[model samples]
Target: MPHVFEVGELTRAIKAVVESEFPFVWVRGQVVNLSRPGSGHLYFSLRDAEASLAVVWFRGAQGGRISAGGERYDPLTGEVYDRPLAESITDGMEIMVAGRLTVYAQRGVYQLVAEVVQEVGAGRLWLEFEALKKDLAAKGYFDAARKRPLPSHPVRVAVITAPAGAAVRDFIRLGRERGHGAAVRVYPTLVQGEAAPAGIVRAMLRAVADDWAEVLVLIRGGGSLEDLWAFNTLDVARAIFAAPVPVVTGVGHEVDMTIADMVADVRAATPSHAAQLLWPERGMLAQRVDDAELALRRIIGTLLASRERELAVLARGLAWLSPARRLDRLAESFDGVDKRLVRAGTGYLDGLSRRLADLEARVSRRFDARSLDAREDALTRRVERLTAAARMFVADRQQRLELAGAHLAGLDPAGPLTRGYSLTTVARTGKFLRRETDVRPGDKLEIMVYEGRVRAVVTDGGPDAGDKS
Candidate 1:
């Protein structure tokens, strides 16, 4: 009997067998058809002259776990190597890849899942560079917010570079021409080889500590990647990040970007560009100063004109308020008032003279010397008669007043009291007591006599109780 298998069943059986037979392997070839989709998964074909194999590297698989040279490692921790294999890989690069063979069940195709990768020639150095870059980026050293703006016209620029190199010379010459003769302080440092990173870091620290310049420029001429590897070191990147003042980096050619450039406050394409960015040309600055002076003169002239207008207004007001003018007006008013007063006085004196003459004429006609003598004699007779009548009236009134006084004296009640008679009154209310029934036996009494008043308590008061009243 012949048996037929289903398509899905057949594919699954083949996938199981191929994956089990080649679970892990190492393949060496030139990379081609490298494509990274938006999902961050790398797909490529490792091809030789005769054949090719499909391979894939997921984004998460980059620093997950890898094995190289018969040893296992965690690329994230830098346990065994400086960097993971993924970072050093590129298209057309001859590489040795370590991975597991896996089969896609849907397509029924077998592919290599890459775990580790390494470049053929410059594998180690590129790996270290990648590692340091990743580390510093994770620590926020390459944050855009931390970058500082460059000075527009720096008066003093401190340069950290090799003194003997063409980079320093170019920088100094350009700064002199464009920077308006800015002072350049060169902190000579080794820009290549083993001792370069430490030397650059120390120079940067010293430049900052000494307050050397307003802006610091770290420059080096264009070189191969190996020649410029010192600027790509972790120490140099950190030094640039930690500088107190703004740091400008110009390392290698325009195409090359080192870690120092990424961490610096500002990145320049070349040493000459760094100088141009730091300062303005002398001729341009002189033009700007001249423009500013013209603007200042215009402003001053406007202000002076406004002040002069204000002073003229004040002078007009002061002229109106002058004391001499006020005194002149007052003198004019006084002259008018003095004329009116003189006219009034003259009119009044003439009226008085006319009235005096009329009164004198009336007196002269009405009264003669004989008539005045007759009036005097009549007045003397009347005065003698009035004197006699007043004497008679005064004597009569005096006699009548004496008689009335004698009558009032005889009728006085106090006069009776002085002649051995006494008057009694109830002491509580001051009522006169005329009879025995006027008071009670225990009542207090006041007796009025000639010399003094006597206060006594009544022992007996009713007629039936005592015979004497």
Candidate 2:
């Protein structure tokens, strides 16, 4: 009888045989039934007509997207292989997968554990793109510090794009509709295909050499990676870097970004956006002007009102300093001084009289007839001395009073004015004009004398020639 084995054992035995025989293999086919679960393990079916093989690409595996002449790494064994694989393996792409043929022990099924995946034909282009991007980045071509600011309101804009394309038309149309009066000069050029790089370089050079516009705009409509590949060329990127004027790039759609966009001073989302950026809308500009004018008017009105209030205050002050007012104040001060002097004199005299009476009373009370005679003589002598002292004090006080009165009279504002000496004050402000700077040309000055005031205008003046006296 033939020996019989358990089902699991039999499956394991067959798996070992297949894996040992074809430990590593290369399969080329269209990807299908791709499933990437939460494990980050990529699962798909590699199928070519009659045959189909299950393949798995684990995340963080040794292998990455394969490029032409790039090294291939084994995901399962962590070993480098001769055959390279593409970094990304997606459904519907025709790719060459290099991995180890392995057994799924639990399910007891055979599958290819993909380590490397390479795009069938476009691997070289992708390699070149990545290599150039790395080189340019190393040279600081994509540095943010190198980027320049766009002009706030570019009066003249030079657009480099295909003349008949929608990009140029869109740019021009937007400019005409909204760009106040910005001039849009067009330099027609090919934006794609093999001749595109050379055409773009020439056009950029021409725009810079001729100083065509204040700012240069490079724009094109949306297309696939290959369709927009021309913008990614090294020549076009260098030209953009070397542009004399600020460059604004609006290539392809919003999702697509090329090397030109990276190197440009500004990147817009679309051709229409580029136009809007290069020019300000006429209505908006007009509104801005109107706002500025209104603000200026408001500021001027406030300033004028403030000056008017100041002038009014000065006029009021000048009125209060008039001759009549000054005379009235002086008269009131004189009356106060006279009353104080009279009160002081009367108090002193009363105190002296009281002292004399007290001294006489004390002598009468304490002295006998002979003593009284002697005391009376002494008292009379004392009286004479006191009288003399009182007379001298009165004289002194009288002299001081006369002096004070003379000083007060001299302080009279009318005193100087009455002597033909005029008091000059600033025009309209009543500020005492002491120096030449106090009054400028065309200034109206008030000249006040004893009789009245006169208004005079200053035609010309110089620094005072020192005090003569």
Candidate 3:
């Protein structure tokens, strides 16, 4: 009899043969019967019109073999990708996949263990895009150092887009609603189709030649990759690069990016977003203006208050240095001196009278009646001389005192009031009104005559001042 193998042994032998025969291969077909279970593995069938093959892409092998290899790095693009291939897969989509061939021992069936998967049609476009991107990047077109800063307050902006597109309309509306009074000029262009690249380049060049805009905006609505391919053209990219003014691009939705977006000075998610980046919010700007006005008022108020305090200090100092104040001080000194002079004169007279009485008493005790008479006559002569001398001294002091009083009276500020001249002063501040400009109409005034002060309100402040009531 012929030798027979066990079921397990047969399955194992087939698995070894299939894995060795086709270790790695690439397949192209329409995707069908796709399923992703909780095991984080993708199960799908790739079928052409005639044949179908089962495929399994374990999660570990989608981006990279995490434990077996490092992160998924693409040598062609010089970038790392962490996305799962399943994310791009859909039923009935034409896809190309590459993986190793293996046989499942449990089911004893052959399948493809896919490592990479991409849509066929889009993959070609992606390859072109990547090649261009690599070339541009090598030439420093995508360098951050080549990028420019946006203007803080752009006064003139040129918009390049389809005039009838909703993207341009939204941009214009947002600009009007939120911009800081910028003059927006639309440079209408075709943003799609085979001629779109040339149109965009022309629009950019025209806008630059006009030199009317501080910045240029290139914007378009979201669309399929083919629809937005114009922005990825070399002509458009070069045109944007050679623009004299800074260029801002808003080509599509946030998920979409193009070469124009990369080379632009700034990139925005949508046309409306570009407007927002260019101009500040109207309400927010108004609030800032109001805040600035309030701050200015506060600064002015603080300055005025500081000046008023200084004026008050100067006024007090002026009052202290006034002639009238000096005159008052002089009068007080004069009064003090006069009182001291009177006291000294009265004391001297009392001492002389006491000496004379002592001399008369001595004569009464020592001389007889004849000698006493002679002595008395001599004492009377001396007394008369003393009295005459005292009279002269008193008369001299009285004359000197009168002279000083006359000088004091002349220096006195109030002396003029005693005459016909009257003094006018501000009733509110008690400041002397020396000039016509000192008072304004409706100011209260006080008039000082010989008797007393008269209160009045200024009716006219002119060369000839007039007051009433």
Best by lDDT: 3
Cα lDDT tens digits for candidate 2, 1-469: 9989998888889888988998887788999998878887788899998999988888766343342334343332222334334335567889877778988878877899976666654444545677888999999989999888987777788889999999898888888888557787788899989998999899888888887688999999876456778888999999999888899999876556778888898999778888877877889889999999999999999999999999999999987889777877877887888789778877988988998899778978888988999988988898899889878887887888788888878877668877789888886567988877665667788888788888888877634523321
Cα-based lDDT at residue 112, candidate 2:
94
Can you tell me which runs of candidate 1 are displaced by over 4 Å? 1-127, 331-469
Roughly what TM-score does model 1 have, to 2 decimal places? 0.49
Task: Mark the regions of model 3 whose C-alpha exceeds 4 Å error after superposition.
Answer: 1-54, 57-117, 318-384, 398-469
Instruction: Summarize candidate 3's per-residue lDDT along 384-413 as a digit string, tens digits.
Output: 999999989988998899898998888777
> How close to the true structure is residue 393 of candidate 2, measured as C-alpha lDDT?
84
| Model 2 residue 131 distance off true place after TM-score fit, in angstroms | 1.2
lDDT of 1 by residue, 1-469 (tens): 8778898888778878887988777787899998878888889989999999999988877764444333334442223444555665678889867688887777767789987665544445666778888999999999999888887677877899999999999988888788566788999999999999999999988899998688888999875456778998988887888788899999865556788988989899889888878887878899999999999999999999999999999999887788556656655765675567557655755665577567556755787878756755765575567556545555565565457556655555676877799988897668898878777777898898988999999888755556754
TM-score of each: 0.49, 0.53, 0.62
Report, for every candidate in turn, its global Cα lDDT versus the true structure. Answer: 0.78, 0.79, 0.84
Ranking by lDDT: 3, 2, 1
Ranking of models by TM-score: 3, 2, 1
